[model samples]
Target chain A: MSVLDRLAPELITGAPLLVMQGIAKRYGPVVALEDVAATVWPGEVLGIVGESGSGKSTLLRMMNLEDTPDTGTYTLALPEVAGNLFDLDRFARRQLCARRIGIVYQNPHQGLLMGHSSSGNVAERLLVAGERRFATLRARAREALDVSEFPLNRMDDPPRLLSGGMQQRVQLAKAIALEPALLLLDEPTTGLDVSVQALVLDTLKRLQRDRAITMVIVSHDLGVIRTMADRVMVMRRGRVVEEGLVDQVFQDPQHPYTQELVHAKL
Target chain B: MPNSERGAMVPGAVVLQVEGLAKSFQMHHLGQNLHAFDHVSFTLRAGEFLLLKGPNGVGKSTLLRTIYRSYLPQAGHVWFSHGAGRTDLAHAADVDIALLRRREIGFVTQFLIARPRVAAEDIVAEPLRKAGVAAEDALEQARHWLATFGVKRDLWRAYPTSFSGGEQQKVNLARALILPPRLLLLDEPTASLDVGARAALVARLADLKAAGVAMIGVFHHPGDVAALVDRDLMLMAKEVDDVAV
Candidate 1:
């Protein structure tokens, strides 16, 4: 079945969970991002590609409404709620982001508290998602760990003692613990070696398939984006240089920059 | 463990040796005990890169602490053998170990908790200062090492606190390399770095290995250790095994 077919019929009926139109952001004298438009459909993985200082992070922040864009039309079809993300007040935006979205940082060490155990790491996010019952939190955390292919037997070990690959898996379990509708992964496997990177990415793709978890993965590595993304948006100099299906963008990239990236991959 | 390839040098000329090392802690508050390291021991040659691998709480930290003389082991002896000087550290004085650390060993802990908000350059110079080098000469040596580690000249004066974890790691690395100690101990040195930064650090560590600066790297990730180390030192429940390269 197609990605949209996996989603609930109600969500697919002309309802884009995230919609960004002409979003723009500036930091002092520098314009970090400008004129970015995209749509994240339920059960689909959207890849965002850009180099350092190219404002890919700014775009990801704007997508989840973490940072307000200077000027843009932004709308989110959140579960049981709908609003313009850019226009929402602080509390409202935070509430929406917390309930419907989750973000995983690139630096695995900073993403999760290294002092806490695997179960503790997963439960922290569940508690934040408003699930406070101790037994329920444990159940959910274990379930998430199972889905992410994490070794549940070693759930009591602190993150610092776990292997680097296992640490990244704990970060994944934290993000997906609450079954967030939209997941944002920023260079999820950057520092990990090839074997660990393969494991983590495979786990992510499986969860995205089984749970219909829509994702927005940001990466400087084109290979990473190509592997996970159903739809790709190329960002450069704070703008959308190209946007299309992954196959179309990778096979017949329209932008000259896109051509260079594809050529580099070969 | 003994070094089999003792050629012109004496067979017992191994730089360092440990036999049946073990450590445990009594948690008085919980009325329970924690075994940090158990029956773990290995040998270090003049320039060997020893990589320690295990899960969290599996005693990697404890092993490093024991080797660096920070935490005394409950059982097992840590000995240093170099040239005519053979020192058994199990019964060595704390002050003597401290002196040895200052003069012969350099250590980098896993966490980067800043103590002094000194400039990156001066922070590296502190070790040389303790070694009795002139302040001006120490600063020049520090600058050379910093440049070697790829820290820009403009950023030399920047406080380590202001830099990212990777930058701070480079500073720590520079500090450890400035003294040119006989042995270097690292715990999770690349945990906080990105791909580019990690590659740079690994490249530098390879150079250090070539120069025969004996090192013991405690790493949680086998992949990271696999890239730079020559052999694996896997820590099982209460024993240590030297996995072949």
Candidate 2:
């Protein structure tokens, strides 16, 4: 059964899934972000592209509640929670990050418990949420693995035993098992072999479509962004220099930096 | 990489992306600028072969040199996938470029630059020898490459300077393929070769493609290698932008 069938029918706010304003962050004297504002509507895929130091990642981390903006306010905008995510108690923010959001990193090692069985990795989230039945855990994890396109027989293998692409698939499986309202991907296909990258991206594109899941993807590769995002934001020196429909920004960028970046891509 | 332009790209680590690369030369005496190639941009994943096609003097050779850092670009960046990260070739340090040349990158041109008195075998073996392979073993490997490229064994001990045009081009190709670099840049490598030898080189390149080597090649006649090319970069002729000297 799909994991969505197991949801407890929690109330979701009619407001946009995310709302942030005047976000600013700095490391020592170096400004990492400045007055960045963004809003992501539910079920919309927003692509973030930038050079290495362009604050696109810093912005994503803030959205995931992994990093906090020093000046601006941003929140999950859940109907149940009236306060910004940072203002909540540490435990509350952690709970929201864990239950309501899913994240995939470029390296699966960062997300997967390497030594744990693939099924163990996927069930860990469900277990943490207080599910105690072994059969249910196994079943749900199996279903998630199916959606991830991972070979069902390999479910018992540890991520350490899987190929780089397969380990990434396991990460996708674990992330989606939670049925997160927001999925955050950071360079999801950056390091895989070219042939394998195509497969993983195909799987990701399919998963996103099947679930109609909201995603905010941060990738340096424009080709990666083009495949999945409807809208894109180009960031430079920690500020959003351009934002528009992906085609418009790529084909006819108003900002010169955006133009250079677009044309610079293959 | 065939359908990569349509949005789905290969899953391998990106091996090369030449970004907005442009090159031109300043004629000091004439006080005019001569543009080679401009606005050149393309990306290659490992194992992809990109054929650079253009009219004479459109700067296909210049574009290759700019990527190799033989000619400094007039504009743009060459982002080469270096290990887990990437290097902008246009701004990379000479020492770094030197190391990359010895390890990950290889270049081949139409003319063979043979040193005086160096035997054809030793010339092909030079790269492996410098990489610390035993001299005898390096030469043995060199002979294997030479044979694969259709070079006659009788020429093994002879100096390449005395070889025919086709023979020298074969020797040049053998030397470049000796190391099987991750990124190979070819500048009209088949220009000096006869039909049979050109076919030999093309067959050898097909083998390299299967071994996952990325290549950027300039060819006047791409018909023979068309089967191996993943993308064709058509460089249009550029109008010289005369600048104040």
Candidate 3:
């Protein structure tokens, strides 16, 4: 079948879900971001890549609304709330992020609550949202764990006792449990074993098939970005150097910095 | 006979006029000047198919880039027909060239550079999207073009990066022709195709020519496009021997 057939023409028709323009961020003498602009269309995966100090993580953090930009506009256009998210107060933005966005960090330890059991960890956000019934929270947690392909028998185990991959799976379970409009992943498989990384990436691939869940992924691993992202943004010195289709950027990189990055990997 | 002036006899308005075009690279460290081609001139009219023939490194592809304004012409004038008149592309401002590239010209290369996981249909539909066409309408039209080019329905969803060379070329052609620019520059588009695929491509070019989309192309096999070509320009690498390195 044609790719468009699988997408259902109507699935991709709409205004962009998020728009960021002229976004700049700085920490005293350190510039984390500068004059960057990007747009995230619903149902498309945009990959941000660069070397260590290129601000890829900063950009992803900004996308998740965890950190605000010093100057620029970030607009979140959703079914219920459509306006410049930058202008909203912290309390309102935090509320919006809780409901509309999900995030996965590079380290499983950072994303998961090791003290809680796997099931509790997954259902924590739901509990915070005021789901008080014990049976319903258990059901939702189990369902999300199943979606991430984590073993059902391990649901009661604390993430600290589970393997690295399983810990990340718990994080995945929690992130998708909310079914937010957008999912932001920062180095989703950075620290796992080579074998475990493959498993985690496959889980990401399976979850990625649901086009309705738009994603913005940040990775320093070119191979990971090449495999998962439909479009890529190459960052250098806190600025976006090149943005294009993944293959286009890899095969025919426009900027000199991007060329060096692509060549280094090759 | 190869460089014979035939555009004068073609019954259409001029689409491209290149006069005394030349390009060379300066090898500063090597203390040598590498000359690609020199004293070349040609005219292409609307709806005409112009073929460029040359040996390897003879600047045939460079000439096409010069006309497309991808490279600077060391000394020349490239007059392109736009809206109602013509602009000397050699001297046109960057903004003017950008506008013309968007609305009037397209350049297709030998290898396909596309993103992985992006369906071929979306790749073909990209030019239209850049032109502000709606996604649904542009995608519907892209499907039609892919079908016309004989890209399999199953392959439409496959990534173009995984396709065979010939299949990639077909995808490349579909993208360049989706918007049907007034002038199209193709560099070795038929380089890797088998026989039947080459014929299918020539046939498609013939249809485009009939629709008045003028074209300048460099092909590996002249026989593949002979029937569609309105004229041919033969270019040769300029011999330069003096060097200080």
**Strongest candidate by TM-score:** 3
Query: Worst ten-residue run, lDDT, model 3 chain A?
Result: A2-11
The C-alpha RMSD in Å for every predicted model, in order, reads 25.1, 18.3, 10.3
Model 3: chain A TM-score against the true structure: 0.92
Every model's TM-score: 0.49, 0.50, 0.59
DockQ of predicted candidate 2? 0.01
> lDDT tens digits, residues A1-266, model 3?
21111111221336778789999988999998999998777767789998888988888888777788899888878866666787788777777776778888988777788888999998987886678899999999999899988999989999999988888889888888878788889998888898788678767765776334788889999988887877788999999987765755675455677767877899
Between candidates 1 and 2, the lDDT winner: 2
lDDT of 2 by residue, B1-245 (tens): 12222222233658887767777655433456777777777778888888877688777777777788766666777888754256777766443455577667889998886644568998899888756678789999999988888888898999898888889988999998887777899988889788777888898888778777889899878887889988777778863231111
Give the docking tier of candidate 1: incorrect
Residue-level lDDT of model 2, residues A54-166, one tens digit each, is 99988988888888878988877565667677787778777777778888888888898999999999999788767889999999999989999999999999999999999
Which whole-number lDDT from 0 to 100 does residue A110 have in model 2?
A: 84
Which candidate achieves the best DockQ against the true structure?
A: 3
Model 3: docking quality category: incorrect
Candidate 2's C-alpha runs over 4 A off are: A1-14, B1-245
Q: Cα lDDT for residue A162, model 3?
A: 94
